[model samples]
Target: MSGIKIIVITFLLCLFIINSICKNDICINKSNGFYADYTSLNCQTFYFCFNETLNKTLQCLNSSEPIFSTYRQRCIGVNPLYDECYLVNINENHENCAWFSVQLSTTSNLTYHYSCLYPFLFDLESKGCKHYSQVQCNQRFEPKDACDYHHPQIHSSIDERPCWLIPSCRNKTNGFHGNQLQECSSYYECKDERFLNLTTCPKNMHFSDKSKTCLITLSNCENSTKF
Candidate 1:
């Protein structure tokens, strides 16, 4: 063979070998039969193998609504001391609740039974209490105010009233210098403190020779003008 043809044949053989190894490493076996690629949607990472009798019980429950109730009594017969068995309602709105039961039971001993009554099933995990009637997938707790009693406060807005202090006279009054009241509402000293200027002072009012402070005196000048 020519040197160029030999090089091309060698490259083709190498490419074929790499492709074969890639195909073998990616194959995954799903429970529903077909061998799928690892990245395929049908191939899940987790698997569980229940008892054959339990598997048959679940299969019967999945088929019909009435069979779930009938299987519950039969389940108790299989294990009278069964700790958990729940009856759940299977309506259009309560479909997610049914799915939740199936998902939770994958790792737990809880068995879901279907019913037409107000409470569809008794949850064995919750001490035979009824599961939530309806499941809201994205339901969230949004309280109106920060002081609401039910939900725990996780975060708060900086603009909220409880987080800031409002400017007011009650927090402003500091002390009196001679007869003049020297009041301050802030933490910093006022630079331009003068009579009738209305300067905002800090905790300590700036006093320049005490005369700059204002005095509130009782006025009787109308009766005794000359005095």
Candidate 2:
């Protein structure tokens, strides 16, 4: 192909990829008005489209309000749950809501911790961390497991990465491997070092990485203690 034609094709391909993905692209087929970009665990990025063309792509950065609310159709106040939650200065005795981050290989949101500082808790109304005494949000004494934020079924229109991209099971010759982001209850059994079979534990049992088996006893999975 001629160089000019090749360049044109490359550009078109990029656009196609963008439209296929959610985070970087939202101008699919004459989109007019604002649309949310489902990226990095939240619908933050804003896109302005009209007549099958994207006019602007905006970000909620360098401002107090960074979270984009689709209901409001605009950026809102400061979001304490903006990114990864961390324990910078924690009080060992204090009961606080701590969060753990879980990375998904195929999801747009790699992971984000949503815990407030030591003395404060995440306040939904204020849209930021505030004194725990004033906020009615649920409080936990300890941070939940990373798997708590994950779900076994990823019902997304976007394409998921190949099995090779999965770090835990990529090189496994055989045996079950737990997916931390998909909760510990579900796991993938690797076979012949090249195939994967999705497996879930029997009801009331969760997969256990420590013992490499499912058991009726509680395991460190989402709400396992409840069972």
Candidate 3:
């Protein structure tokens, strides 16, 4: 190949990888060539390898062709198989939620719209709502706020007020307590036996007894001991 062609090839490859190898070499055992970093943003960004080594990480942000199209071997605005983020441009409404009415070439008159639920965002590859933190999308959406609660028996005596009051807090100056009646959802932060408020975890989330904070849960962990 000509020198100019080789340079072009190298530059295109650089779009996949750079000279700086990341500390966490995600490409340590790969064969070679372009590969997407599916760990977080799906394939909006990717890496290139040669001889089982990761070179650098590159992205497909802020461009007409904003997505790495592995099938086409380059960046493209849209691919029926894996993209909807760019379609976001067609609609000026930039809330975390949106509706897409794309008319695909192969499928005539087939238009569909989508709305991403809270704590989740629209994923181009999956063409569905995925947790925002896990997918690389063009917009931002806030997660649902934690639910609110009042002491079940604010009128009752401090020592026996609620079903889940920690017996330990009565003697201490300040501490946190969990609600067994509303297990994995509600808790209290008390200054001695008197305190301000009762808090609940966000939708579907759980409270961690060890940390006194709301957290994502995958199992019936009644309480999270891990921070």
In candidate 1, stretches whose alpha carbon ends up further than 4 angstroms from where it belongs are 28-32, 35-227
List, residue by residue over 1-227, the lDDT tens digit for candidate 1. 69999999999999999976654433222111122122322222212212211111122222222121221222122233332222233222122222222212233444333321211222333322132332232332211111221112223222345411222222222332221232222122111121112343433343332343422323211211000
lDDT of 1 at 175: 35
lDDT of 2 by residue, 1-227 (tens): 69999999999999888765753334544224565555533555767766556777887674677666532346767545432222132122124342222333333444533333333344444344444455563544432222221223333212234422343433454777665555665666654442245677778776776678876765445322211
Tell me the number of clashing residue pairs for each predicted model. 8, 3, 0
CA RMSD (A), model 3: 16.8
- Hey, what RMSD does candidate 2 come out at? 17.8
Please give, for residues 174-204, the per-residue lDDT of candidate 3 as tens digits.
6665655466576656452333356777897
Question: In angstroms, how far off is 183's CA in candidate 3?
Answer: 83
Worst 10 residues of 2 by lDDT: 84-93
Worst ten in a row by lDDT for model 1: 218-227
